[model samples]
Target: MKKDLIYSLPVLLATACSDDAEPQSNNIQCIHPGEDLQAYYDLLTQNPQVVAAMNLCERPASFQTLLWDKVREAEKTGLPPDAPKPQSYYDFGLEMETKSLSGVSFDSNQYQKIEMVENAEYDFYFPAKDGEGRKLIISNQVLERATETFLRNQEEREPIKTIYTTKEEAQEIYAAHLAHSLWIEKNEKVPWSIIDYNSEQLGELFGTRTWFKTWDEKNDEYVISLVLDHSPRETWKVINDIVDLEDLTDQKAGVRGSAGYRYSE
Candidate 1:
């Protein structure tokens, strides 16, 4: 009964929220990880629960304090049993990459106050498709952990070594790689008779990924990078490897991967 209840909870919650209620009309958004770190950081600074979540019952440290006290953890000391992991305090990227790409869950109105920044001055920098800006949908758990380290800065009053992605720079980065990239459009519909996307094809497996990572720099130490999330590769794959719908049912099923990135400060 417990197992059944647990299994049915996700479906129940999803069903309760969707089918009838218009998700789009309700100002409900799926915020992607790292979409607006600064804004989220501000929220973290103000929210006591979020601050306590990060502090984990220890002396509050700077945001740069990446990892947690593992030795203390082993000794069952310092942090309480429920503290978040260090990597958890940064980004959902590693989990997204490692976790099986089966479900496409997204963060909704739970963290709704994550303020977005847009201006006419940067109008020229906007991408051709969405002239306004971009939006990402992250999970609640991911958002909770991701903000801990960032919010620490507020408690410690640490200097913000923020690297704003400039319009010209953003435009330049977009043009250099993704401007002509194949994953910009939606893929053909997936067939219903599919099996598994990670089936072994000798050494290389088959799957659907709409995101990629690209390093950017002016040949210097200070380099700003962006992780083209799942939306970017909607059109195709890394090599634009679009499988035939008929072929999908045979061996290579659908393993859909989303895009995310690491914003180093």
Candidate 2:
């Protein structure tokens, strides 16, 4: 007969935090000043390794130069003339807004193109804030995929496999054994001396208790039994009352539960 197995593993638990950061509003925004912009551009240009990492090439470079020209013009006039700016320019400006608030500053109305690459992933470009010539780009592609793959592999490697067997079988076995055990615990009240003694002997006899053989021909009757351990008189009475012995002899037609029991013809 085909059977399904069900098992459980320990679950991880966490305590809720008493305090958490409040969410920020979306509509309100800030911009950077001109001197801060120049400082940001100077820092990126100074870091050759950072530049190479972002994959900044001719077009991005030329665009960045134009942005610098625009920044210089903004400095001269203290205002920017309306013109078509590269997407990179807006992206970098947003980044600068965030970074500048965090102690980083850049020139306003200038543009700088930076590429960010990490872990063999495609590079992304960010333009400086408000057409500032300094942008922050990060190579996030590789890192994201690597983290996902690691989690997937970890789950695949777990040792325990949860099984869903036939529900009828599980219910029968659980009811039978549970009733028997409860009866013994309630009625006998065996002295600690006898109880302890019996436990050692029984523990050795039954390594672990699992569902017993089923007898129901149509639905597969199941019962639970202690391995090598005889049931006490009271316990046996409860088992006898709950379990149908005749059902144990018949073959079960189907299995149920989450892991789904297998049936062989």
Candidate 3:
């Protein structure tokens, strides 16, 4: 399904007890991938919620140090055998041109230029339309082309830096890295579908809906439920029966897996 769909689940909170304590809610706060980074960073310095979610003290320097330490650890151990590889960053830029029609005093001719900022590579162009109010449309077309080109080019690059190691460390880094990267990548048009659905697809192809859900940072693995709303129980059984057959097939031929679970009533 969609990453937004998985992210929409209710945040589960852990509770504590005390003799004179007020009732505590278990709502664990989470930061959306699209939230403003500077604001988030600043909030991390001031907000208890952000600090708790990141499992850090309310000090930015401390958090940075912790992250750097993890990076060094990953570099030393290498990523886990099954961890997804890291991606690279790409920058995008846009340019636009417009011309008024001759004698007609009407807007007509328009052109747009879009390129990757890093390599100065031109990727797309937009031309004007023919209509009574063509000038207005052409202007919009130019802006839209520029925006679209930027988004497309941005999608071609990886959203974060990653290193491989053991499954345990990989899991931790994956969760932490994804949490941060998701925020940075939101609305930037990078690949979200790839990170969220590969595992689910693999499960479906194998006809098995049950799989292990391991946190990227922790050793805990939970049994998660996976099924399309329209999927049948017999189909699931078939997948379960042939789960081992995956190794016999081309490793790269199947869909990737995701990290969350879903249930339907």
Candidate 4:
């Protein structure tokens, strides 16, 4: 659960709340990892948990601290008897990756392994993708730990019948999930303040109200619903690539035009 940190826009600060009640540091600039940091990216590629903690982190140190906290929690809960608890981020990552890969019942040769370094080999290996659709690169872990927890909680319950969930409930869950992700990744305490969004410019996100169209099994008809236009990370990546390509093409065109011209001809 997120802390109820009240954050209003700069314009509304005066009328919305008393000056004494306002929290300090309303706006803060965050530094993201750069593309040139090959060593840092390599470390992240090896550690999936670290990557999860880094998704929304403002500073690089925040993710390491988050991972350390998790390790401390695991220790307090009691690891297996005779199991050595990890003391650092590198140790914890290695231990978890090893534990996740143990007791595998299927052939692992079919899947691609994530390498620690392109030019060198490592002792441990993490799969690019598990049987499920989870990606080790972006996801916390490829094993779908969330599903595992859900199954464990429901183990003693009666056989499943109807699964019920509302759009409002889902929106709250979605927002909380993203909020938590930002906290874990970026170490941002308040969800709303994690990304300094211009509330006035974007207004409220009506997109939260959009829902997927579901098929009515009993009526045998397609249920029409408000559709959400997804702005996925892959979409932005493709957009950036397209922009780079266009710039390169323009440069080539300029070069060709210049080459065609001769001095005093």
Candidate 5:
């Protein structure tokens, strides 16, 4: 059977927050990693070896001289007096917007660029709010959710032969996908976690458990499980008992996967 994302690592790296920070709790909402990553930055600053090892800073100071020279040449040539102002997605929809040639203290990017959707007409539907399609440095959990969502929606949903067959290849591809998803964030107007696990519970609405299996070659057995919620077979048993003996209005449905919604505490 061609299965999708059942036992696979997500495109997002399943990165644990730095051990320096508190261990992440399962139910609590995760803080956006970049918003207040001062601790992470401090750790990197004290350890030059860690920075070099991670390659967090990709370029040397001199490398920008080439681009800077070109920019300086353009500066001497001066922009036309009637150069167009930066356009927002609000005005252009999905079409590309023009940017101001002259740098300013305030720019169009500061404003919200909302496009119409069925549920919410004024929605920033594009990746990366500025629409510059710039890349972001992201944490592992977000990357994993991004990857899993991507894999969950593909047409063929086949494992990449190179990655599936070799352990090293798998790690390389996983890292690349994490980086790619980060870049995708730069192109959009907002950022949020995939907010999955609810979909796992959605399965029981039809009297079926959503789970997947993988071969355990060393043990010579097949392992069956669900990623977000464990042992759907067991969870379904409880739901079945509830339906047989009790009225649901008096009892909150309890499931292991969903954090708290529609599931008991």
Candidate 6:
């Protein structure tokens, strides 16, 4: 059976903020600068990598470059001759008007681009209220929540394959997983320990817990016991009080696998 897997990673504070600066909390409201919304949408639609990276809600240097280039190109041709230039930074923000999930909503004028230090990597810039510069870097937690909300509304989701039966298939999943891990590390400055944990527990472990039903011919029937006979037998219901040993075993294996190195993470 085909399944859709979405892994959630923990959000970290951006590395660009100075030691003296306090990191923005998820509660802080960021006003979207009301930049070219259509253009920003176009940018994201055209670039799948950016979409995947946004799933992490942390922007890397390459993602920054892409945004800058998109805005630059727009300035060269799309903007009017008399349009005022952005003070010091590009006026790009996502106005996810009328879209929301959980307790999070992207009301108009309430979302801003995640800010980063100029020419710096894995860092964010949050200008003081009395100071002059870009004022907000969308909090990582807020961004992650927003991304989840936005992805749900999107018609076509980026479906990442989780369970593989062959080395070739496993390699593809590994490559994608590795790429995502590297992107998170580079942009969010997340440690490998956390990444590996999420990968194993949320990924392989969850897959194993649900794997039996996925391949079972009588998938809808209640699993009474594991039969060794090759022939199809009568299905029987199991006691509700029975402990899910399979789930426990999968968790143990996932924890064990995470303790050691894997092809990815």
Best by lDDT: 4
| lDDT tens digits, residue span 188-246, model 5 | 21232212214223222211122214323335433223221222223434445444323
TM per prediction: 0.17, 0.17, 0.20, 0.18, 0.17, 0.15
Model 2: what TM-score?
0.17
Per-residue alpha-carbon lDDT of model 1 for 95-146, expressed as tens digits? 4333211111223423233321221121111111222344554444544444
Q: Write the per-residue lDDT of candidate 6 for residues 161-231, one digit (tens) a residue.
A: 22212322222222233333333333332223323343334344223122222322223222212321111
Residue runs of model 2 more than 4 Å from their true location after superposition = 1-165, 189-194, 198-265
| Candidate 4's TM-score | 0.18
Misplaced by over 4 Å in model 4 are: 1-198, 204-227, 244-265
User: For candidate 1, what is the total of clashing residue pairs?
Assistant: 13
Q: Write the per-residue lDDT of candidate 4 for residues 1-265, one digit (tens) a residue.
A: 1112222223332223222222224342122223332233344344323322323222123432332333333234432111111122122222344322222222367545554332233323445665885766635453446325433433445322222234333323223333233322233221233123333321232112222243232354332232221222222233343443234344345345444334323
Model 6 ranges off by over 4 Å = 1-166, 189-265
Candidate 5: list runs displaced more than 4 Å.
1-163, 189-265
lDDT of 1: 0.26
Selected candidate, larger lDDT, 2 vs 4 = 4
By TM-score, the better pick of 3 and 6 is: 3
Best by TM-score: 3
Q: How many angstroms is residue 190 displaced in model 4 relative to the true structure, after the best TM-score fit?
A: 21
Global CA lDDT computed for model 6: 0.29
Q: Is candidate 1 or candidate 4 better by lDDT?
A: 4
Which 10 consecutive residues of model 5 have the lowest summed lDDT? 80-89
* Stretches > 4 Å off in candidate 1: 1-15, 18-188, 193-226, 230-242, 250-252, 256-265
RMSD versus native structure for model 2 = 35.4
